[model samples]
Target chain A: MKTENFYISDFCTLRNGKVSKNGEQVYSNLESENIKDFAKGIYKFLELKYPKFHKMDELCKLGFLATEILFQDMEKIDENTALVLSNKASSLDTDRKHQDSINNREDFYPSPAVFVYTLPNIIMGEISIKNKLKSENAFFVSKRFDAEFMTKYSEILLETEKATNVICGWVDLDNDKYDVFLAFLSKKGEKELTKKELNNLYNQ
Target chain B: MAELKEELKEKIIEQLSLEDVEVSEIGDDDPLFGDGLGLDSIDALELIVLLEKDYGIKLKDPKEGKAIFESIKVMADYISKHRTK
Candidate 1:
């Protein structure tokens, strides 16, 4: 197996009503403990007016807002860039809502709006539409964030030239508890995409 | 008719999750889909569900929605005539 080093060009994390980039804080919402309000605060802080944003579920909002922060000061993401995201909950938050809409025999109201977000990969779709990225994308469901898998999968895309860049991270939300860590990877950057570095960034 | 229109506008906003749109902003003849309100096919389904859930009016033929959902006035007329609840 040929091993080649890749660099994390930029990264963003959204957790606990706070948003950070490259280990520095960009925005914080101490007042709003709810992920919905926190994500909305980030959107307002960024001054984004995308109307579709209001329609996304909680998990998609987290991933979408994190990506927005990740690319705020950077150039437009390459259309050839791939997206590789993993999350533990896998849209369970929205799934429960959708299920509840039909759980009652008397008040059954299965909303298409909520049902459309039952899958985890729909977040990738929202991000792709916003960034206009038409590259390879994958969503993995795991019990926890697997730094090694993310690193290796992203590296394979970079090495094979299948993508000029890769956006990799964990965007997990369940029961109002959420964590998002997005890293943009390419051939040139200040930090190498090693397992240790990825884990450290995730922990940071 | 005027009262029903007002009620329909409120229900549409709440049912469709039109968070940014105001009740007064939706004119009687404003298009519900495409450029008028920026609604999509999913929203179309949502409108169908709303018709059944709120007004007890099930849309037997989905194609009838285009004309009925064309505007608030049209939806009010349809619901007033067809609503069982």
Candidate 2:
């Protein structure tokens, strides 16, 4: 019988060349002025040398970078961590890249590297692999970022014991536009999560 | 034949996400799978696509990927004989 159940323990948001933790700026005014370059700068800032990062589509890179920054200071990462991430664009950004590869008959190349990231869940897989988390995970495509939905779903997973810990948020990107809001959730924390609180945090 | 092998090596690195690897590192006669290049099944599929998209060689069976993707030397020879465009 666990008391003081379900709290969104720590949260991180990355947008427009900045990373914030607990609604406070951690890294800001990134040297890169554009989104494409900003993503690379974040990867470099994190000092990640994983070759896979260069191969990933922009959406996966954004999510992967956010997760890396969120968990940078976190000491103990649980194995049963379930990732519940949602996005408005789904995998359209990479889908467009895949389409471009085959659209031109003269320059046709249905590249497997580009084709591999056609699914949104691939971002979760990338993060899971990097974090060494082999557990429950889900990816959703919505018209808009739904903070309430994320909180509710994460609570269910934690309450049902499907996952001991959860990393949930919005990792949406299309072209140069992007927004990432990731939160770490568990039953053993002080900040009890509510819909409004999640909304406030996500908006930050 | 030497030119073709060198071309295949460059294409393999470009097509696949072998970012850290350079064209000079991959040997023409070296094994493409397991120890030599460490290419897995997914890389094999990418090579299959490379054969069709660049050389117009369609491999309908999955088993065909093994013999064709053995080495850059083998791939160059196959492409030289079969390339349509």
Candidate 3:
């Protein structure tokens, strides 16, 4: 299979508890409570734009947002599609809190809630539940965001028929800031995917 | 007695990250794991630590904790009997 077409549906960046673009407030509706709230806010924004999806999870939210913006009637896309996600910090917030509990003698017992989020793949699990997808899932850490890896992996997924479609991108959440960019790629003859096309779709 | 249970609930809430759960929502006899508040194995471990830290009750085996931690009521009773503090 070759990529037929691809698109950039929706992207969100939350910084300092506010949503902004180029230092200008585009939307600001973040309540600083926990990571779940941040993840939910991103989900809600995308759900509003694409109402077809019934469940909302971090990874599914990213995939839906990208698909809605890029593909038309994304529900028509095959369900066996693969997902490739990359992040700089792999649940560091939860890891740090678990470490903090161990560091202090008084609070020597680590909270299990903090420990659950330590794995980087939890986001993938959330997405899978949301989309009802039982597809190949992978999570990788890069020193910095690597767009090339995403492009190459997506290509392999399509060419190998492991997936007719691939949803891939970078999602990183830190102390008070987060950034996400996702794209839905299909086989070339079935869709339009080129290096320049993908660069333009994501680089923005 | 009520004050201690209230404190325990607060500690449980903070430790578990039960963001949607409130202090008033937890019943005195509510099961702390499986069905009532929907806690699981990881939560059980956290409660074990809470017992050790707050009441100086060290459970040598995790299996021993299952019966003692059936619910907040059971947990409170066990702590009252075994607490060094």
Scored by TM-score, the top model is 1
Better of 2 and 3 by DockQ: 2
- Those runs of model 3 whose alpha carbons end farther than 4 Å from true positions after fitting are A1-27, A30-79, A104-107, A187-191
lDDT of 3 at B79: 81
lDDT of 2 by residue, B20-64 (tens): 899999988899998888887778888888888778888889798
Worst 10 residues of 2 chain A by lDDT: A1-10
Best DockQ goes to which candidate?
1
Cα lDDT of all candidates, in order?
0.91, 0.85, 0.65
Each prediction's DockQ against the real complex: 0.77, 0.57, 0.28
Tens digits of lDDT, candidate 1, A40-115:
8888899998878988998999999988888888756789889999998898999999998999989998999999
When sorted by lDDT, best at the front, the candidate numbers are 1, 2, 3
Candidate ranking under DockQ, highest first, comes to: 1, 2, 3
Minimum summed lDDT over a 10-residue window in model 2 chain B is located at: B11-20
* Model 2: reference contacts kept, as a fraction: 0.74
Model 1 per-residue lDDT at B6:
95
Q: What is the TM-score of chain A alone in each candidate?
A: 0.97, 0.93, 0.69
Across A33-122, the per-residue lDDT of candidate 2 in tens digits comes to 666678777787788888777778888888998888878888989989999999898998889989998898888778777788999999
